[model samples]
Target: MCSLCGVLGGRGHWTDTSSHPEAFTHVEQPTRRRERQERTRLVNTVLDHYGLSLSDWAGSSYVLKTKTGQTALVENLTELWANAEQLTKHDFDPLDEALIDSLAAKAAR
Candidate 1:
């Protein structure tokens, strides 16, 4: 599908739900937006290792881009990782020793 269609047809991912699923109503829009921002920040910490960055796209999707200008609009974290690998030509192994070590170091600091 084209980027525009994908964006227009976006659906909420399971991870995007709040602890109180019913809180997904319009009244909770602000809270949901904040959550997405936090998620983007945390994801960026991992993407940094691969020269990629992610930003919340209007609180609906993510904008993933490489240091060299390649980009992808992903609907969720699962798509984010797959597209990240494609853009960087590198595997994004969560269990990668270096990645775990890096995250550990960050937590320690």
Candidate 2:
């Protein structure tokens, strides 16, 4: 629905009651938004050319650049199982999708 009619039709990519069935919340953190766009582009480029998901190397983590142009990694530092949450579906390789699924699982616990 989303890939075809929703997003393609400019109806909505997040909400349409076809899947979510709820009013979606839109949070526009500029930093996060820019990072997300960059990550998405990186993932698509990598996947298209390399046929590999970044998660394979990242162990399902994301990296960030700080205001001072420094680098930081936001990860589950709890020392839990590398995949304890059973997050991320088997075939969902796109960075944004996998991250969302992974985060959802972590939050549920």
Candidate 3:
């Protein structure tokens, strides 16, 4: 028997469906891709409203610059949005509050 057959007890590693119950199942990559795209789109929509945008730095992190000239290194969309909402709440701007509410509602969905 070949090396693969010997290791799999005479069954082909990729061709044998009897030994591995999940040999043909492919069900996670595309869902994750769509989720990532959607998250990025929603986050960008909110950021663009405030004249802010995410700049890719390295890995899964980004740099966000606020309209007030403040900068933050946000880990992800959720963290960045949350921080923005909190930081802007000190001044009590109605438009900002409404925008944050809209972002929160969309994120919850």
Candidate 4:
């Protein structure tokens, strides 16, 4: 596996997914205390930066797809947040093509 998969796999070890199938805990950082809290924070940032919200997406659980959806959201939101750091950019805009493919798949509607 490559870096993305490696990261995903590591995150997998952090949570209990037996009941919820794709459940995961993000790589804990000083900034993030819990996985869902981090995701909630992520949702707010992405919504604010891109002027979009998870309310725009069709599914209830984007995390059902991957452990990195928050970051994927951030990456996706990059074009809208040109100068923000990896975290505070408030962009889930899928900047890299590979990241787009692995995460949100071009976001066409």
Query: In terms of TM-score, which candidate is strongest?
Result: 1
Tens digit of lDDT per residue, candidate 4, span 51-78?
Answer: 3333222321221112234443322222
- Give TM-scores for every candidate, taking all chains together and pairing residue i with residue i: 0.79, 0.21, 0.43, 0.23
Residue pairs clashing in model 3 are none
Candidate 4: stretches off by over 4 Å: 1-33, 55-92, 96-109
Over the full model, what C-alpha lDDT does candidate 3 score relative to the true structure? Answer: 0.56
Better of 1 and 4 by lDDT: 1
lDDT, each prediction: 0.79, 0.36, 0.56, 0.36
* Per-model root-mean-square deviation over C-alphas: 4.2, 14.9, 15.0, 14.3
Show how many residue pairs clash in every candidate, following the order shown: 0, 0, 0, 8
Tens digits of lDDT, candidate 1, 8-105: 54445667765447756755455777788889889998888778899887766689999889989887887888788877889899999999999999
* Superposed model 2: Cα runs more than 4 Å off: 1-30, 50-109
How far is 61's C-alpha from truth in model 1 (Å)? 1.4
- Report the Cα lDDT for candidate 2: 0.36
Error of 1 at 25 (Å): 15
After superposition, which runs of candidate 3 have C-alpha atoms over 4 Å from their true positions? 1-38, 90-109
**List of clashing residue pairs for candidate 2:** none
For 47-97, candidate 2 gives per-residue lDDT tens digits of 333232322224334443322343333332221112222222124333666
Model 2 TM-score, 2 decimals: 0.21
